[model samples]
Target: MAFREGGAIGTALGFYLIVVSILSIGIGPDLAILSKIAPGVLWGTLLLSALLSVDRIFHNDYEDGTLEVIALGPLPLELVAVAKATAHWISTAIPLVLMAPVLGMFLNLPAHGFWVLVVSMLAGTPAVSFLGAVGAGLTLGLGRGGQLLSLLILPLYIPVLIFGISTMDAVLVGPGSFSTSFAILAALSLATVVLTPFAAAAALRMNLQ
Candidate 1:
């Protein structure tokens, strides 16, 4: 489904690159300043890029009654939600994560920080997809749900963002340990993966009714 919607992925990647490029240019040629801010900027841009296609996670299926059909299947709705969210992580978040290293070059990210940035984002982005599934399911059929979904989901993304950046900063220059922060970030992803399916499934049921 994601590949069929190539424009969405392309738009997200384009947006990611453009935002990083603009910020790099706007911040000027100062490698020190760029490196200092690179982790935060890359992570922020990644979150926004992932969000671009989130509303569409269930929208197409919901609109065409496919969701109802799927709900009637033997597999439970929670599992269905899990599948949707997983697909989203693979299609959307993975691409953005892959692009982060290249973007890091633009921002003059410290060599050591590059590996940490990628690892941190990998450990953290699953929460974005899973938690975002809840928002997408809630706003399933609502018009202009994208705006509301952003409001609903971005707050939930805070912990992931905080820990994600913290993990990178710890590696680059920090008072904290990378292992501790990365552990927390990974825990956030694991928790969301375990718990969000139920919330998303409930929302999907309400909207389907």
Candidate 2:
């Protein structure tokens, strides 16, 4: 599927960047530039990859009747949305986290930077999933929902993206600090927790009726 392909491209690109960095041992400034900017690059690529993968969250279910049953189930729709998004986070986001070590190493990240990437991504990807749900819900019935999805989710992801990058960036080049960025990442995740479900549920209801 296109959604899976998008995620694959993202994962592939991240690793490709790493390989390029290593191969550039004496060829150019590739490793140096990657080291200086790798955290942001890593998080940004992961976010994009995860975002692209979310397009399938409800597309098939809605086209069939599964979403209808889910909607009418005893449990709240928001909870269902949360569950689906959590699954998505596990599949897409977890891979990115696992790959961070390789990426950090390629970027010449500080010895401790890998830890920072893992912790921050663990907290951040859920938010990406949560927010992507809203986008998915909004574009649920559109033929070109994927395009709209990117437009909607990108702005919402900025906060998480910023904090995630900042946390790892600090590990690589700053004062060895993380409290502030980590708090911001947690806050962004919390904000999505509060805001996305209402929109996702409302969109689903509209599409159903």
Candidate 3:
């Protein structure tokens, strides 16, 4: 399904590139300023780009009755939630992560920080997809739920964003070790991967009823 929805992936990737390009232009030619803010900007834009398609995670399935059939199958809804979120991670987050290096160049991201930025994003973006599934499931079938979904999910994304940037900063010029922050970011992703499916599954059940 994710592969079939090429436009959605393109939209997310385009959003990531366009936002980074605009920010680079807006920041003027100051490489110093650009590098200083690069980590935050990259992390923030990636999260927003991921948000662009999050509402569709379950919305299409729900609308087409595929969700009902999946829910009734022998597999648990929590695993279904996991499957959907994993597909989202592959379709959305991986593309964004792959593009981060190119975008990071626009932001004048440090050479040393490139590897850290990629690693941090890889560690943290799963939380974005998994936690987003919860909001997607909660807002399923609602009118104009995208705005509410943003409200509900962006807060949950903060820790991931913060740790992600911190991981970059630590690698670039840090008071703390890179492993420390990266571990926290990875832990956040793991926690969401383990827990949010249950929450998303419950939300789906409520909506299905």
Q: Per-residue CA lDDT of candidate 1, range 112-190, in tens?
A: 8888988999999999999999999999878889999999999899889999999998889988899999999999999
**What TM-score number comes out for model 3?**
0.97
- In model 3, state the lDDT of residue 194: 98
**Candidate with more favorable, higher lDDT: 2 or 3:** 3
TM-score of each: 0.96, 0.84, 0.97
Q: Kindly list the per-residue Cα lDDT of model 3 for residues 17-81, writing each as its tens digit.
A: 99999989988999999999999999999999999989989987888898898888898999989
- How well does candidate 1 score on lDDT at residue 157? 92
Top-lDDT candidate index? 3
Name the regions of candidate 2 deviating beyond 4 angstroms: 1-29
RMSD of 2: 4.3
Model 1, residue 56: what's the lDDT?
A: 81
RMSD of 1: 1.4
